[model samples]
Target: MNQNVQQAAAPGLGIEVSSKVPMHWYNLNADFPEPMPPALDPATDEPVRPADLEPLFAKSLIAQEFSSERYIEIPQPVREVYSLWRPSPLRRAVRLERALGTGARIYYKYEGVSPCGSHKPNSSVPQAYFNKIEGIERLTTETGAGQWGASLAFACALFGMGSETWQVRSSYEQKPYRRLQMGVYGSQCHPSPSELTESGRRLRGQFPDTTGSLGMAISEAVEVAAKDPRTHYALGSVLNHVMIHQSVIGLELLDQLEEAGEEQADVVFACAGGGSNAAGMMFPLLGQNLRGGSTTRLVAVEPAACPSMTEGEYRYDFGDVAGMTPKLMMYTLGADFVPPAIHAGGLRYHGMSPMVSHAVHLGLIDPIAVDQERSFEAGVAFARTEGIIPAPESTHAIAGALDHVTSGAARPGEVVVIGVSGSGVLDLAAYDGRF
Candidate 1:
């Protein structure tokens, strides 16, 4: 190693490298012990065929949604774009461990370095690419907390395609900067429950004064895309393809851990909303565990206010309020349930990802929920020690890790990994009364 490399490799500072980006995305379905329940067509109460998804998604994404391939090659164009921010650093949280006074070794994969300051871009770029290649002129989608909207807008801008988003009313009001970010990326943004679509108008009439939900926003976006042949919908999470695209995170982390000389992680913690972040960061490791190559415990942390995995029932439910999308089999707290307006807006969804739900059902994933106050407390502590303010959604994982340590559940010297899905730079308002 060079002089600077030798210094960086010194014990206790955590390892950071930039050359370990994965060339392929690992598909968890290939390693799943059983076939996940297929998405159901609401009209027929039968399995949804790829043809049924034709109006919303590009052909390439639809193929990936149904694919059983173990590893999908990342396209050269997509990889070229990813090179700008791929291989995000995995840092040992020495300061955080010291603050907690715990012997357990904590590490975090920091994904805030991306252009959108979140992991959403991992999938958004590819989603845009696939749509552009298929001659789609514009993409429409929903957002909660605006990360996904900004990400898709950024990706669309890169591909020279137009984009539009319907953001949940709560986040649109709370995070105005996110909408500005989207606009800067050359996309149009609207608040959910606007009068533009029938779904939005109906929702507005039904709940006039209420804070909107991700489900509601999804209904509006889906309605718009279904009506326009030149436009396609790009979902940020809760599907097979999104999770597969996110696998780059876990794939890169695994390589980084080996390079940093860690044998294996005892547990991996990641905040789960629609489940893309957790799935992207844990699926590769979980696949190894399923195949008997590793024994890492995969933990999906969620907001207690909308604890789908922890408190919901596993059943077929609509992914959106208006039921415009297919009924997916997963852990759900009713399609229309509106969670309390918490700072972690990104995690206020009513259902979990089907793959994550299946993994939880089979006991492959341990799901946990953290309340708002405790999560914010953990985020503050981590920021004070590590010098990076975590996104409200990412705080759930920090809280989960702290819970494991403070509760004496983590063994001394055990290796723990957390996925810091994003930065809270633009979310400073969320911390106004939080601290």
Candidate 2:
């Protein structure tokens, strides 16, 4: 057995933990079949340089955003924080498989054990550390489902920095517990389109009764950072560096699977919002495939209500509603598009990550859309069998995995992994009144 791995005491339980955490984060940028499209300055329509992003992001993050290296060393400080919840458990979904009577084996990499109850902290910690070392006093960010806001708030608290977040209006009204969590972490939170910034006011004037979207929230947060020299914008997802920070998920999975005596997963299912969770779970394996090592199918499950990967057009689009941010080539449903207030608030973005979009465009990753009702059904079913209630966003992956198995697409004896990005403890309201 690898020194990093520890098998479960009970054999049939199939739960395994890693004694070690990955010291380096994997980057798919070096192995991408084609270079991803560069972010362009909205004003000049030319490629954005590191200096162009200096106003919004930390210098270290900007280097990562544009880095071509295959692996980057994880700072010891960041790694120390990660050790709190790194090497999260990987378990065989024996009950779930028996419930479905599927021949294929089922496994789930659970990331809810973090202090923030989600995978958002995987990047938030590093983002906070990087900004703190550079003398940044505060961080401004946007969140759709409140997970990112709470995670950033926790990270800022650890690094002794102030955090201000604008959450989507729908989620602000629906998920109050997440807001409370952020407040407990000593961060200020607001509903998007509030009268906080010029962008927010303009959006409110244009759509007075709008429920708000991630794009609008990003504009509000970015506006604040752009105007303040001591503050920097921290994005939860849809950025290259965020994706890289999240790669720890897959790196750990690679070792856990091998230590458990599994060769390779036949397919991996992960929910795609800004694509951070999916990228974190699949990027390492996809890198292997790029190097002609594995044939694992990386599946990105998105909401049918906001199907950026399946229905949106691939093109250069603004990352925010107000056009204050750079434009990147990706699958976009138009920055102005406001999706329905589905329970999966995080997946309601108008655009996918440029890196994920590039993989979709090249056929490296498979994209599928799941309806909200079906997703909730899957969540409820899994809770009954697995005894863990998945977050509304994570239900999309469960629904997708069930869809694949039920559709007879998965071969017998194949191993399938699901990325459970977070827990639904604070999201009980979404499950209220639903079966």
Candidate 3:
């Protein structure tokens, strides 16, 4: 490796951005005991071909989807964009530790400092750049809590491209500022179940009074992209390429923990919304557990209202409610399941990521479901102590971490890391009613 690459990949250099981010993104597909099941053709029930996916994704990303290669190099352009928040701060939550009256050391990787106020930009920028190079003029995507929509909006603006997003109905209503944030970044945002796409129309007909889910929004987004030759679909989570882009979170986090003079974390917590950020934060640590035999525990926390991990069936299911996309093998609570209203609208998806589901099947992550009240309690506690209000989705992780800490899953003096994935600045409405 070159001196620059070595320094960038070195452990204990967490305080500053690596002069250069690591060249390659890690892919777990090649390392799994058996290959992850392929996305199947909805019509033929056969594995989808690369060309079949070309209609929706950039050619380069389609290659990354099923790649068995251990590492795929991050494009220089993407790395340059990531430089803006490449090394997000990892702080020891000393006050929260004292407040909990626990002897366990608490540390959190704060991704809220990013321009988009979340880890979504870590992938969105790259997706936009790849599409920009591929001559795509417009991108369509779905979002739940507006984080992904805002992130993609910012990315498209930076790349001089047009962006369209269909946000879940519940989130759109609960977080109007998030939709406005997308508009601020020069993107059009619509509530899912709007009269824009066939899937949305069908959903309105089927359940006139129901709030939309991510699956429904995804179908709407995909419908528009499939019809427009110049538009390619972008997904914020649940896809392999997105996970690859998000690995930057875990990579920097490992270095940060090492630099903090904490050699290991006994347990790590991240909220699982289609499992993007959590998988991103835990993938590298999972490798250590599998290959290097590390003892750290990985946890995936989800809202009880949409507990795809803890209660869903592990089976082949469509990513969208309309079943427009290829069928993936993952933990799913049925595409037709309409989750109850919850503040963490982002976690109201019907299925988890196929890769993450495989890990859970292989016993890599412990999935837990928490209620809104418990998550809010934790979020309030975290905000009061840490001075940064966490998004409702992130509070699931806080609840999970505290559950582990109090239940004695993590012993005294043991290190614990929680993935504080986003800032809830745009979600103050969800907090106001509670407080």
Candidate 4:
């Protein structure tokens, strides 16, 4: 058995601990397949092999690497800023186990305590760090649930830079706490398809009550960022670098589990929107798999309303709310598609992360989609059991765990790890309607 497994099986103090594994940048090209073309546009459809993305790929954060002793050092200032929230906690979910009435051991690596109240800051801090190091003075990005906006705002503030965020319209109206959170972090947030940009104005003109989409917000943010040299666009997910940055979560979890005296996880579950959180939690485990260790099932849970990984075609697609950004190969429903107005607004995107899409295609992971009602049911159950009201986005994963437990799919002594990516304190309104 691997050291992790051995430690997990050993008896002693139940505190989890992680090995000091040296951090390294993963080779994106080696792990992922060649990019494909967008499926929605046939006239412009064409293959987008990894070679074709050389220019864009070169700009990836992983592509720029340095080492300072144990940590593969990113550029300065960004690294310095990241020190503020570098190490997040990997927690044991004993509360969840008592609620499940199952013999399986369960743990959750909580990512809600970060400045932005989600795992988003894991990437946002790095993105802003790099942009500032590159002499950029302003950052622009789009937000669905406002977690990303708040994270970026916090990062920009740490780096003495300015940030502007385009919030999805439905989310802006439905999740006021998200906007308030972003505003607290010093980001200027505006509802997407607002009167601020021509695209927003035109979009509102067509769909007045349009609960904005990620694609539309991306179009506006990218337009604004690309227009000025001082401003650079930042993405919350859907890129290899973002996933790479998020590996810290898994790194910490690996240690935490060891401290908890548990063997390797039998199953690892996470909710995937653009796939950053799931990828982060899975990357270190992927390293274990590559080492010819015991196979631990990796699962990605998403909403049925926007089941990009489960139902969408693996093809090139636009990464924006309005289909205005450069197209990339990924698993996508459609760039023009609009998801249901679910409380998990962050998971409403029409596409999966390219790396996640590639991983799913290669059978490295499994995808499951649950509906809003069911997800909320899971979230409420988790709250009652775990005592942490999960964000709607994370409830999808909790629901999946509940399914496994209630169905008796997990055996006694088996272990399951779920990524509780955020807290649902901002989602009290969602709970008000649930009961």
Winner of 3 and 4 under TM-score: 3
Q: Over 4 Å off in model 4, which ranges?
A: 1-86
What's the TM-score of each model vs. the native?
Answer: 0.95, 0.95, 0.94, 0.86
Range of the 10 consecutive residues with the lowest summed lDDT in candidate 2: 5-14
Compute the lDDT of residue 158 as modeled in candidate 3: 70
Best first by lDDT, ranked: 2, 1, 3, 4
Q: Which lDDT value does model 1 have at 307? A: 95
For all predictions, the C-alpha RMSD in Å is: 6.9, 6.6, 5.6, 8.7
Give the winner by TM-score: 1 or 3: 1
lDDT of 1 by residue, 1-435 (tens): 366644422222332323556778999999899999999999999999999999999999999999999999987777767877888899999999998989999999999999999999999999999998888999999999899999999988777788999999889999999999999998999998789999999999999997899999999999989999999999999999999999999999888899889988999999999999999999999999988889999999999999999999999999999998899999999999999988788898999999999999999999999988999999999999999999999999999999998888999989999999999999989988777
**Model 4 — TM-score against the truth?**
0.86
| Candidate 1: residue 249 lDDT (0-100) | 96
Candidate 1 wrongly placed segments (more than 4 Å): 1-19
The total of clashing pairs for model 3 equals 0
- Per-residue CA lDDT of model 4 for 1-435, tens digit only, reads 466644422222233232242244343334333442232333356533443333222234534321112234444444444445455666666777876778888888888887677889878877776665567788889888888998888877666678999988888899998888778767899988788887888888888877778888887887787667678888888866777778778877777787888768889989998888888888677767755665889899999999998899987777875555557668899987888777798898898887678778888889999888998998998888768888889999888888987898999988898888998888778777786
